[model samples]
Target: MTRYILTTCLCLFAALAQAQMRWNQAYQQYINQYKDLAIEQMLKYNIPASITLAQGLFESRAGLSVLATKGNNHFGIKCHGWQGRAVYHDDDARNECFRAYRNAYESYEDHSRFLAGGQRYRKLFSLKVTDYKGWAHGLRAAGYATNPQYAKKLIEIIQLYKLHEFDKARKYDKFFARRSKDIAGKGGVLHQVFEFNNNYYVKARRGDTFRTIAAEVGISYRSLAKYNERNRKDILEEGEIIYLKKKRTKAPKSYKGRLHYVKPGESMYSIAQLYGIRLANLYKMNGLSPDYQIRVGDGLRLR
Candidate 1:
């Protein structure tokens, strides 16, 4: 009897551990399946990938909910002006109308368009794409959902699974692939491009001029300068960031609550270079004057 009791206890413990592990399995599967679509939407609409994924997870119950499975509505988007196929689901009201899609990808695309085209969600695009928390709060404030805890729940899901990392990773992968193709076609050395805050940049090499790099990369020199917030005539210094695209208004989510202590001889330009951020954006983020000088030991917010 004693042996049987001990065996039963061990089995129960193992079962509980398995159950705990499986608790998030569904969520993980949902992320893996739809992460690419979320990233695509982010690139196209400037929405945070983390916010998109969290909403999908919450509204669709990781695609296991009846609304998702039966209606193909991953975002719980209702039929406001939607003319596509739709289904009725019990939401805030019994048998509420929800927009349906032919497939999950259509649902994802519609969600992006829905947010981008809506006047109420326009302000969300101005926030940093990495700011999932801000987006969550903004969505709640914009009446995306009626739940008072909507923002909290989104933040909880984002933090629990570290979904913000996907935003940068996916962008990097796409940019890297495109850069590789460009290099391959030109039969030249692949210029190393680095990512920060979802922007792609390359270090200025010796004798690399803006016009020359622009010609090599197939972008206009004026556009490159505008993207980097620099004058076209500005001399390109070795190891300085030459952004291949526009910079974000803020830094990555991981940089929140973090400060960069200025070291001796570190200028604002140098600090921005260190983080691969645009100089103007760095200044804007900290509200520093154009002529502001950095002193040793001054704390600068990176996010």
Candidate 2:
């Protein structure tokens, strides 16, 4: 009798696990259908497509939740400033006020813009899409959800579903040339040279790890490690100034204004001259674009 009981428990457990796996598989299918829309929104808003998709999947339970069925709110975004339509649904317990969208696309667009327009998320925009870890942490810091493990859950979903690849930029012109016709038109190409103090520093985004910045800028990680006064394994802080070459660095000058998009074959020297600003001033205001080799469509601060 004991053996039979144990066998029955094992079977039940296996069945439950299988059911859970099926649910996850179904959720992935839902995400796959909307992957392109997510990527498009990410490109326009700088939010990682993975985060957007994960939030949608989790909150809507792969579109099986009542909120999604009735209201089309995949992320459970509240009606804090909502002026459109509102719906109440049982979430934590009592019915909660949620924003209602006309369709799923509207929800995605609102979520992306919500993060982008918020001042708290402004710092996160400086990060690259691949730096989902930082963005995950940032979201938590910005109070996206109440759960303590929110970032971990989102990261797990992204990895399990291979959503991070959406952020990968097409560096090869030929590859992007074909992609441009299918996707968004050809990506802009602009090269920038970031010159700082006596030495030059590579322009870096928030998502750039010290190791990645070092590798891209052709400096030893150890050298960068020593210069930044950080441990070799330490993640880099956004806007933490460091020199590409080993030398004493000076405080960068700050320019107040909006960033201008760099065009193809544009140099920092020419950009500065065109804006009627000193090259050094322009370099200090911006970090990564001064390197003289900038990609087209990259934003440069003009003010």
Candidate 3:
């Protein structure tokens, strides 16, 4: 009898653990689906992609909620001052109005811009890409939600899935080009001649901005936006689709190879000598002040 009881208890414990793990996995998959939207927003507005993904996951519950599935509202944003269409739903016993979008990508883009252009989130823009935790907490402090533990919940989601890794800088010219080609093949944008992906997308791991992506893919930024049906003032979302026009890569005058960061104890003179860039050009590239204090991690353009 003792042995049987012990075996049953162990099985129950294992089952509970598995259930908890599955819950976490579901959240991760939700974020993965929309990560690109977060990355695009990060590049455009400096908001960490992790925070964006976490909030979306929390609000949408892995895209299983009716609001997300039917309305493309992954954020549960209230229609406080919105004049557009809306849908009312019951969450805490009372029905509330939620913003509606034409598609999921639109919601993601609007969310990013909402945060970027809003004065309430002004302090969040000053945070570093890696300081996702700070941003998460700051959002709570700024009354993003009524829940007192909102920030903690968001941080937990971000850490559990390693979502903040997207904020790290990376080079993805080829990937962006390929993605652009795929979107163009689908006939999404108005002008295929100059279209590029205009949809919001977050850097899943690390990636490029629309400007950098447009330049590398040989498409104009204006064309990229027009093709994707997005405006210059619109925000980019993670996993969001943008229009891409087919074009040949051009060797522009500003096409420098790749910039290298100056390490500790390294001077501008040594960097210039190593890269074969003139000292004056080096100074100009980095926007050096009269003191010329090149701290670590200062960006330098390489040709």
Candidate 4:
């Protein structure tokens, strides 16, 4: 009986060691795969790359957790006014709903925006980019995580992986500084444009006019309106999505057969903008009339 108990203890120890080795290997792979994205987020949002990576490692378990693997929810963000698909999982609460993404890159982008755009995390941006410790603690103080040792764990991960080095890279500083100037011209208007589904788009800010944006992007207002399926005389609203190229007839395969639940103040045009689909196609896909009124909680096909 004594010999059997000793053998069982040895087996358990070996198994635990092997699991640790696998976890370490996974963590290393995760860092290598996403370090560039983390750096990009840091340049764009002023968040520390180390803190982003450490939080990703902890929350997603190096992208191996069910929420990360199945839902592409790397940061474990919950559905707060989310207009897209969602998944439920037990996380601090049972069957909690988390935001789902089209891919891991989308998850990373959303995570950066989630922290940068939130009122609670505004103070974190005041800290130096290299101040990973302060950021880590500030995140905890802002109720980012429920764990008492959340800050300690983030610091430990940062130190162990030397993730802070990414933040101190001079090359990124020069690159982003030049990029920022080009994107945000005189008057602080963000004229930055990005491409998705082979279409170019710029987010509209307060006081942005199609004529102004057309001049900045060197595209005609007529062409811009045609591309976005809007009338040339339409007024641009703050935070509205303006496409510089034609939207796709169908959404990406990942969104096939997906239905969007209309929220308050969301129109068919807004829903098309959200999914990057052509406005006419959106109506056709759902067999709705051009003047169809979408009520709150109504289901609209997105594919």
Candidate 5:
């Protein structure tokens, strides 16, 4: 009898574990489906993608709620003077009216405008787009939801999914993804990223262009150009080092007190690129003017 009971308990535990796994998969699928919309809304409306996603996930139960599935309401936004199609759902009261949309995109867009246009959320706008915590707490304080734990719930969701990455879509640049070989789906091109001077960079392979590198590394094309101090349309050589970050003014400490001897076929720009230092700073360090001529065998201080 004891053995039979233990077996039954083990079976029930296995079922419960599988149910949890399914729920996690559902949440991840929900994020995958709506992440782009959330990011788009953030860029257009100056809202944090993390906050938008958390709200959608929580309010819509990962887009599985009746309002979301049937009425296309991912945010649980109620019809407070909403001049559009509507759905009624139980909330603070029975069958409370909620705004409905033709599609999830429309719902996401409306959620952005709703927050952007509301006076109560004006203070949220003042917070940095990367400050998901502030936005989460502020939403509750501004009465965006009646639940006292709304902010906590949103924060938990954001952390669980690492959704804050989308908040600083441009600046953080995938949190400067350390030696991230995981750029497989970002672009088909394969290039090894390296870390130096507390920054990241990648080498330009044969046939690599700024656009291609940017696409592969999940960086903006223009940003990669600026980092490399090159024009957007400039061609990348087979072995050129393209810094993902703005090159430092001086070489790293390890190269201190060392001097770079101008080698044949090398220019000031090439030397700076080699050391991952700013060209302007390199010139400044060696007391060389902007148009100073560098000849072969001339010693230039790297630091």
Candidate 6:
């Protein structure tokens, strides 16, 4: 009897492991297929790509949910005000009205518009594009979900899959490349080198890109990105500052212990650039974890 029980337990464990592996593989495949679309929607609507993808993955069950498979409703957005075709799905209540789409891309686009156009969600747009945590919490605060753990669940999904990497301001993702040609494709290239806190940087001009900047500066692409403390996924944008070398560990010795108040259009990365301080060191000096979203009135240490 003991030997039989052991065999049964082993069989059950193996079956569970195989099911878990299959779910992960399916989720990964879903991400790979829709990541570009998520990034594009982000650029168009100013929503965080990570938040969009995470919401889609969770609501749609990696595109395997009945709503996704049958109605192409990847976001589970209800039809409270939607005028499009509809599908009934069992959610908080049975036969809840959800918007149906012609295709997956249509569903993604509607998801962006649904949030962007909602009066309740207006405040979320004020957050930096990379502030996925803020968006997650704000979505719950704005009644996007009744689930008490909605924000926590979204954060977990983001960290578990490293989905936050998709929240780039801009980059060479195929979507971005096609969107930004050479420079921004709007005007002539013009930049002036400047110095701050003993670090050198240049303002990215119209139509200027990392490739063009690298060629003009006579530095390799990798070296220039490394110098600017940017990862491979970061993209340069017009009129943005591009550091010529790695930033310092802190603000100038003279500016130590100073407090800088956050303002609109400011982010942790932008603040780090403003003071010519290393992003990681700045976070450390402020006792902020990477997931801490800086608010407009928040004060940050400049040491």
TM-score of each: 0.50, 0.49, 0.51, 0.51, 0.50, 0.51
- TM-score, candidate number 4: 0.51
Encode model 2's per-residue lDDT on 1-303: one tens digit a residue. Answer: 999999999999999856644436557656645666677777777778788878888878776677677777778888888899888977666888899876666777788888888887899999988898889889988888889988887877778777788767333122212221232111111112344444545444577677876654455888876654457787655654555555432223454456768888776655654444555666776765445577789788765
lDDT of each: 0.78, 0.66, 0.64, 0.79, 0.81, 0.78
Backbone clashes per model, in order?
0, 18, 30, 0, 0, 2
Instruction: State the displacement of the C-alpha of residue 152, model 4, in Å, after optimal TM-score superposition.
Output: 0.6
RMSD to native for every prediction? 15.3, 19.9, 15.3, 17.3, 11.7, 17.0
Candidate 6 Cα errors over 4 Å, as ranges:
1-23, 169-303
Q: Please give, for residues 192-244, the per-residue lDDT of candidate 6 as tens digits.
A: 44558877677877766677777655457788777677874466677788877
> Where does candidate 5 have its weakest 10-residue lDDT segment?
179-188
lDDT of the structure predicted as candidate 5: 0.81
Candidate 4 lDDT score at position 210:
79
Q: Candidate 4: where is the Cα deviation over 4 Å?
A: 1-23, 170-303
- Model 6 scores a TM of 0.51
User: Model 6: C-alpha RMSD to truth?
Assistant: 17.0
Q: Which candidate is the best by lDDT?
A: 5
Off by over 4 Å in 2: 1-23, 169-303
lDDT of 3 by residue, 1-303 (tens): 999999999999999856654446566555544566577667766778888888888887766677776676878888878888787899754788888776656677778878887898889888888898899888888877888988887887787788888887453234432342233111111112221222232221124346644653456877765544446555564434444532222212454566677799777755653443445666766667636888899767754
Give the per-residue Cα lDDT of candidate 3 at 12.
100
Query: In model 5, how large is the Cα lDDT of residue 170?
Result: 50
